[model samples]
Target: MGMMFPTSLIGLSFDRFWKLKCLSSMGFQSLTSLEYLWIKSCPSLTSFPEGGLPSLLLHLSIEGCQKLEKVCKRDKGKEWSKFANIPCVEINGKFIYDPDSHSD
Candidate 1:
């Protein structure tokens, strides 16, 4: 969980990154090409970076993050809008929020 790589990283997945508490503000921001991201079982992760997720992220799934409350406030803003175009999002084995389903 404490590593850095090229900014060209297209896809990243963190499975059982136990020690990661809070994601860096610039973590996903710099990964402009990141499309798929999956995080699982990082029990210490309480929340997301204040800046929000990457703009090009198409798929995101997180599970077993018991401390996490919300990805972002449910509202019209930069943080919320980041997920507006995402095709798929799943949390804790369930799809809590879906753009296609909520559009109606």
Candidate 2:
């Protein structure tokens, strides 16, 4: 995957970033400056890698990815467990079920 930062980007409070049919299986990583990410119609993308983004990420949108089952799976002793407090994450435009939730 090509790793090149766009030249026009400055004062990076990006409200939206869209990638369609171009993102590889690797997925975009380390976009710490991005606020909202829109990934659509990328069928090959199955799962986001563990520890994929900066902790500052606020909004994430995933849609039309039929093959994706989970956004990020918890790997024991991995940073995926730390995302419980990241504020907002949506899968297929629906709120994700908190893996940490329990029934009593």
Candidate 3:
């Protein structure tokens, strides 16, 4: 088997699990079944893969990533627009883009 498990992982909740700090890379390439992702205080993480996350991912939480600029951007094409409408991603305890907020 691979370093982790198979592709089907629904309702998976990861909270403050400090072990992630040592992991050089997190391979979720085939986690097509993942629905919810919760990550916090991973100070060493720089970025996720460049193709965006699984289409089934509903809720995503990322915090304390002081070095992260863009979460996931398409390597080619106009795929950046695909993420323009998704509403389930939460970054730094706020919605990805809030019209009323000046921080964006």
Candidate that scores best on TM-score: 1
Q: lDDT of all predictions, in order shown?
A: 0.69, 0.48, 0.55
- lDDT rank order: 1, 3, 2
Candidate 2 per-residue lDDT over residues 32-102, each given as its tens digit: 46555555666656545455544565766566665552434323323346444456755566655556431
Give the Cα error of residue 3 in candidate 1, in Å.
Answer: 3.8
Question: TM-scores for all candidates?
Answer: 0.72, 0.53, 0.63
- Each prediction's number of clashing residue pairs: 0, 0, 0
In terms of TM-score, how similar is model 1 to the real structure? Answer: 0.72
Which residue pairs in model 3 clash with each other? none
Q: Write the per-residue lDDT of candidate 1 for residues 1-104, one digit (tens) a residue.
A: 44566789888888887888877766666788888888899888776666767778888877887665354333533345545567677666555475543331
Q: Name the regions of candidate 1 deviating beyond 4 angstroms.
A: 69-85, 98-104
Listed per candidate, the RMSD to the true structure in angstroms reads 4.1, 6.5, 5.1
Stretches of candidate 2 exceeding 4 Å from the true structure: 6-30, 70-85, 97-104
Error of 2 at 40 (Å): 0.7
Q: Identify the superior model by TM-score, candidate 2 or candidate 3.
A: 3
